[model samples]
Target: MRKREIVLRWHTIGLVRTGSTNYLIHLEAGNAFLEAANLSLSQKSKHDAATHYVNASLVFKKDDPKKSIQCLTKAIEIYTGKHISATSTLWIGPFLSITYTTLYTTKFSRVIFLVLHLEMGRFTIAAKHHMTIAEICEKDLVDIEQAIRHYEQAADYYKGEESSSSAMKCQLAVAQLASQLGQCDKAANLFEEAGKASMENNLLKYGAKGHLFKAAICHFCVDLINGQKALKTYEECYPMFADSRECALMKKLSEALEQENVEAFTTAVQEYDNITRLEPWITSLLLKLKKTISEEEDIT
Candidate 1:
């Protein structure tokens, strides 16, 4: 008779609307009824809870998160009622944390919470979502170092998983960010790293341009030093040119190395004219490269 009464109560509770005050009363009564009757819900109940959680995630995606969180909490309660394992609990915990963190805001606490959420997204293979959150941290939070860290992490995750194009783009983004932060060496290293990864993955056709980029950076560095070493570095990079811009610039650089004065400059102009007939844009850059080379040569 008691078991029959408990079964009736459970059915009534399940049929009630979860959003109503009466539903809360039923839930409390159902818990007591289940305990008294020694009746654990079946696996079907747990599966239903999982389904509800997924549905709630979609519904709450852009809507009222507080309501979504309520639904998720109820779903979790259902799962718990069926005695779901701790591992499953771990899986659900991050989602709950994400929701709570979104609801609450504090000056110092927000930073910590966002980092936690970022780490959670990273661990879950949510690269696109993780990148978005990282950008928020970098821009809104003003945590440049943390932003770079997440960007690098996202790149590595993509690269390690064979997402070559995405990984390369992520790496490029990090390089650009580093450059903006006035960390030229770090940017150079990231570019070199991306280049190596591209080559090792047989993506050289896509990555070959990076070698020339590195050479340009080295050339700039050389100009800063006003030493023969800079010119030598440029020479080393000259052979890697597959682009018209690089090829033209290489010719201009070679001419500059040979000619040191106004007379040599006149000779270079003639040589440049001969080269420009083959490629006109190259001629335009040659003149600029000549000026740059001349200035550096004077300083040296």
Candidate 2:
């Protein structure tokens, strides 16, 4: 009877879809579940309590974030402690199973916690989330460093879920930010990674032109040898993209870069712009690369 009662309580706490309930009713249901789950403070019960608390917090997230934080903190405490062991975790089958809900619960809770911090104007909090968190980290807070971290986190998470396109976009964001930080090699690698992810997802734009083009440009920013090698490698990887206009532009730019001729590079860029405006980001990187080449010539 006690075990049956515990299972029922666990069901109540675990599957409470707060979005479907009235706010007050959800709160009441949550409190009741918390009470039942806490009746016995075994590891299973503590885990239930943590889950219950997270659901409870989700109810009051908009109006009472501080309360939500307190509840989430309790949840975090249970999950991070050494008590939830592997063997014992197996015994607590229903509680610690690797369901979609189970796997994402901790990650989602952290995202919510960080989102709450962003809402409260706490810009210094760890940047982490699905999508909104990355936007807030980069667009609102302007913390490029943290934004990059969160974007990478998001990419990894999406990759785990087999969300290839979504993962590609996150990788693209990380690559752009890495370029901005002047970590051009890192940016090039990330861009190549994004391109590969896109191709794996059958994303035509990125697979054929977008990411490979950007990767080559990132290499260009570093030096002519690396840049030409990157372009050659990109063409070899995507033979279909070898004849694309963007690739032609890259070839022309490479010649100009090799010659350290600013006029030729500028003319090539303007020629491309006259037909189809280069992405503003690409234009900016090109200008930066031009300046680097010019500076190297002056130094020599």
Candidate 3:
């Protein structure tokens, strides 16, 4: 059993290194790992069986995210049964909503490692693995709120890494997604961090303007005074972008806000849509913002 297991693991790793681009190789790797898992089960080695399941799930992630999620759900479900805790359970929100490919396409290998450590009752190792899984899921999960939670967890984990700029991109991803979801306050804060991160890393100098712009827009969504201040700061940072269409779009919204013209704001959004279609989430957020602004106007 040991020899067979070693061979299967080597086959899986070798294939991943040399032939990951080939779908047939992934299929072969998956089959070999599945066989190894079955062998472990037959031998009544729960630990080894779980390991094989984790490996197989990683092998299948690229070609079959749906199956990967199933394997993850199985591993998580098993781990939950073994050790129940308030802290562990608190972080399992995204995992709880795991459906068979109807929801996410994240890498599940870290999640598998988390499960392995959890089963062994190693809280420290499990916590690190948990953060890694959260990062991966934050990049791929469809649910905005869940993704935000993952991003927050990931920033904490990633802050310790040598390259803080790379961590900033993770923050940027969360901020952009949050803005699209109308979580304006959180988005503004994240975008500010992204801007500062970029400024600190000369490599991201050109990208700072973009981050600040997004942050300013998120601030704009929350309140007019803060919005104008943020927009002015962004203007000071990237003066050349003053005449750009994106800048104009923000300006148009500001003008509408000053006039309290709901119809003009809606029309401006529609006009922007004519030039470039907004994402569904962005559309939803814009409509919500418009509704809120209109309601405020009705009060006085």
lDDT of all predictions, in order shown? 0.48, 0.66, 0.62
Which window of 10 residues has the lowest lDDT sum in candidate 3? 86-95
TM-scores, all candidates, are 0.40, 0.60, 0.56
lDDT of 2 by residue, 61-127 (tens): 5444445545555654554443433233221334433333343355667654543343332111111
Off by over 4 Å in 3: 1-54, 59-143, 180-182, 199-203, 240-243, 271-279, 297-300
Estimate the TM-score for candidate 2.
0.60
RMSD of 2: 10.9
| Ten-residue region with minimum lDDT total, candidate 1 | 86-95
What TM-score number comes out for model 3?
A: 0.56
Tens digit per residue, CA lDDT, model 1, 1-300? 554455445545543423345534544443433332233223223333344343433233233334433444444344333332322222223123223343334366765565555434432253443454456556656666766776777677676566777776777777666655656556656665655555455546455544445434434333434323433443454334334454454445455454544456457557745654423433443354466757767799
Poorest lDDT segment (10 consecutive residues) of candidate 2: 121-130
Pairs clashing within candidate 2: none
Clashing pairs in 3: none
Candidate with more favorable, higher TM-score: 1 or 3: 3
Clashing pairs in 1: none
